[model samples]
Target: MELATKRNHAGEKADLRALVNGQYKGDEHALIERIAADLLAGVSARAGEKPGAGKIVGLSSKAACREIASRLAEWLIRETDRAVDARPSCLPAARWSPEEVLERTGMSKSTLYRGDHAQFYSVVPPGKKNGRAYPAWQFIADVPSHLPHLLEILRSNSRMQVNTFFLSEQESLDDLSPAEVLAGMPFEDRQIVASAQQRMLALPVRARVNKVNALARMEVADLG
Candidate 1:
């Protein structure tokens, strides 16, 4: 029996040994979702093969390809349970260090230390005594500038709070994060941004006491 393969421009087999040597930054569900999407795309691209993905050229028949995809999905679901048993731990921080920010923004350490860059970026410290790490997403492409509204909103200079607010889903922004809405096209977000244009505010974590109290009426939520 042989395995499926995809080749690169150099005619070498592209590595797909993710099971053996992959450092996954995300969880298994997302990986499976991506695979599912890829499968759909490949199948749809083919003109007419009884309404399915193209036969794996390396395989004997179209049924084999379908079987492989089916088995892969089952495997993903089954493997997730085992992964839960293993209890892997990880800390994901999509933040850039001070030096990285300096290189990306063409600014100096002294400038950042002097707190002059606050208007231009969101800076969060990893912990006490550690210098701030900036969220790279805050910066637009090669612009020596920051959004005027973010400057005012993040004025409290509490990086943790500001990052949470921008990253969270906002009801006013149609369930999209403020950061995403800000980064998107103008027409779509014009009303929301315009409505928010006059305000200078800060992000803070709010405790939903009512929701917490409602836990007695339903199954306990996964706090973690």
Candidate 2:
């Protein structure tokens, strides 16, 4: 019975080895080395176990194969963790530029120059003569959160020419309504008016309304 059981277990172990080797997509040589190490450890452990006569007997091939599989699974997990840890945490800062910021914010050339000169947002100075220009990391750090506001401002400015809108100040404010001011425009102009309205709604109510009113005034002046 013991001999029969050993044969059955050995067959099952061989089947498992074939399946593992065939289905596994990782480095087969590395996996084989790890399995060999595990089998050696298992042999050493089994050697510590004595029979009734006091002679130590190592594990059978089936038990050794099982131990190898277990160890290989553990090693793969550790290797995956190490690979993930080896990757960089943040993108390199050298690739950012003022042109990227302008594209992202959709600001006019005048607005971009004004923002740069006024120091409204920080900028990285071009280092020496041949070095590349890059934006200050902090300026870009919060850009994701600030994008909606910036886009709204851009949309509002774009509508002024079509809606015949004007601004009292460069920045938008409250108490402005493009809908009321641009009521008489044709359907094409109304689309611009509607777009401006949507952008205004996303802004602080006071600033949005004020900007819309300013744009309407500018539009009228342009018509005159």
Candidate 3:
């Protein structure tokens, strides 16, 4: 009996022997192998039917095609969602190097990273390079005058939490994120401060205490 054959656009026949022996590689190969198997099954079923018997070959092929289409559609959807979610949305849109930060703020490295109590919020991004990256949102027009005040308000939170705070929308600030509220051309510093204070206050007492305690523990560990 003739085995099923599938040809690529280049008119090259796929290795049905290798595919049947489960020696194929990668998802594309596996999909092609499954399709080949389906076609072979349809052919075998037709060969078994009597010469005058009503054929169900079309129905079998249609069912296999529908299944392959559904699976392919689902795979595509999952891949698209994974690609979207893989994007770095949690971090600020702009991460400036120390050189860029110095260019923007004209602050000396010592002052920029003055031990634990640095002038600016910074993070060490993952990788062997292991250098600091400053979120550009903090330096909207050469570091807003109220930056220190905002940092002080959120001292209990870690740098990551602080970043999250700025990006998060606060209803108290008319549903705008702290970054957005503060970045406004004619924003009231007091209003932004109040919104931040309200957000901190709104946290559960236990959560606030836990975060503060966690920060304290980290500091103590650093000292040791």
Best by TM-score: 3
Per residue, candidate 2 scores C-alpha lDDT tens digits across 1-224 of 98996765554333323223232224545555545554555555676732222222365544555556667666545454444344322222333556765664444667556543222233234454442243322232222222223333434333223222221212342332333322211122123434554454456534544555455455545656
User: What C-alpha lDDT values do all the predictions have?
Assistant: 0.43, 0.39, 0.49
Per-candidate RMSD, Å: 17.9, 24.6, 22.8
lDDT of 3 at 1: 19
- Per-residue lDDT tens digits for candidate 3, residues 119-217, read 358766656356678776665421233355456656777777777666665555456555544444222333443555546545553444444444444
Ordering by lDDT:
3, 1, 2
Q: Which structure among the candidates has the greatest lDDT?
A: 3
RMSD of 3: 22.8
> Which scores better on lDDT, 1 or 3?
3
lDDT of 3: 0.49
Cα deviation at 163, candidate 1, in Å, is: 1.1
Across residues 67-115, which tens digit of lDDT does each residue of candidate 1 receive?
A: 5556765764564455435432221236778788677445567766665
After superposition, the stretches of candidate 3 with alpha carbons farther than 4 Å from their true spots are: 1-92, 115-118, 126-130, 185-224
Q: lDDT value for candidate 2?
A: 0.39
